[model samples]
Target: MEYRITDGIVEAIIESHGAELKSFKLLKNNEEFMWKADPKFWGRTSPVLFPIVGGLKDGKYIYHGITYEMGQHGIARDNEFKVISHEKNKIVFLFESNEETLKDYPFGFKLYMGYSIENSCLSIEYRVENISHEEMYFSIGAHPAFSTPTSENIEFSDYYLEFEKNETASRFPLEGKNISRNTIKFLENSKKIELEEDTFKDDALIFKNLNSKKISLKCKKNTRVVTMDYSEFEYIAFWNKVGAEFVCLEPWNGIADFVDASGRLEEKDGIIKLEGQEKYKAILKIEIQS
Candidate 1:
């Protein structure tokens, strides 16, 4: 099932499967800000990454003297969620840990994805509740793809990203699917990243502890802008398929396992631990200005 929400100026569509965001658009101009899920490039618009952010070492993890096998980015995005609430401008979807989920992730939990639209902004709220008796270790993140070249005359290189504040941070390079121990100089008190076709030749750029919580996607040829604010997240990344017409801005609460991982779930980097009955919430907002 799919739900729609609007606040006069902007509109959005949410799908029950994975509680994924399907569309975001402006009402008057009929302009779309989200990727169209083109199978030729990438088939997903916005996918929710949960239980884990990236790939595990050898695609398995050891938890409490037991080895569990799970794929990259965990199991939330490929499943169905129940629609718990629906309103004109707000909608909520729910996912719970079940018998199948326990086989891969040995924890009981409830995950809710709340989407709300207000004027020109859309907020994606992720709420997690640990229902288990013991401690639970997990991670969550967002993968939202934004369409590029809003006008036919512009090319991908004409687009650029500007941070709300200049950052002096280094990004961790990825060695295959796991995180490498090496650090590459990425930003040096700079605010803008000029986008090009070959920018992602080595895959996505993942950064940690960035000074800016908000980033804007802008094009030199167009006055329109798309900004993302992920204040509570510790990590932010930029990604895209080579030569594709879209870009992804990701905000993550946890990270992937290091290359020399200990194989223990609790020992993973940036792992979030929650006590029984505890709740965790993360908000990611996308604003569009014409």
Candidate 2:
């Protein structure tokens, strides 16, 4: 792991595998931002194609004429990436498919990720290039866990997503290999409950029709807040491990299973496709304050 710092921002490139974020900078109004990525703080991961939030059938997805092996969230997460460029307040990392990937994913592809800091905003950009003659399909997202204190004396229910508007959102549910059209509405209509063990009680909040580019998190004391924005994503997912203290607000170019489809990658809902030999791109931005 190595880091590059400039203009109050620190960008880390993990040369060991997939050149993940390693650590993201948190800049304040009058000071330089800090990067706390010692595994105990924050480590970055790029969840590819199917950011599988749960178990999938045999770690495989059936495509055109055969079945393909894909890890829980695809291969990008675990690959060693190279730092291609670094300058100013931004850094670019690149990851490409190899012999091992070809065995599972037959397409030739290139993924270039960039992290840029401008003032108080941190923007993440992902560019996917199709190198083969066939169309390429995949989903990409960021999984960055912000720090929280357990001794804060605030219950999980003390926090709620504060949308700019009172308009509520809806989401379909998923049951181990099955999709249920049963929907979960947001805001009070979805039932506000405490964060408990084994509770995703309402399933991941799925909002596909977003009129705004940002979403914010508000705590009971109104002390902590984090906002994320994405212009290219059509879906936003909010999730966490049953008892984990961290909440992941994910902006996705594609989504997981819809209530009525087989667990197939190419067939999964919200898939990103690149025309043969073309390129696809998307961005996610986060701003945190306390």
What C-alpha RMSD separates each model from the true structure? 1.0, 4.0
Per-residue lDDT tens digits for candidate 2, residues 88-134, read 77778788888988887777888887777776577778888998888
Candidate 1: tens digits of C-alpha lDDT, residues 100-192:
999999999999999999867899999999997888999999999999954568989999999999988888888888999799998888999
TM-score of 1: 0.98
Instruction: Tell me the whole-model lDDT of each prediction, alpha carbons only.
Output: 0.92, 0.62
**What value does the lDDT take at residue 192 in candidate 2?**
34
Question: Which pairs clash in model 1?
Answer: none
Residue 220 lDDT in candidate 2 = 73
Clashes in model 2: which pairs?
17-79, 17-80, 18-79, 18-80, 18-81, 19-81, 49-139, 179-259
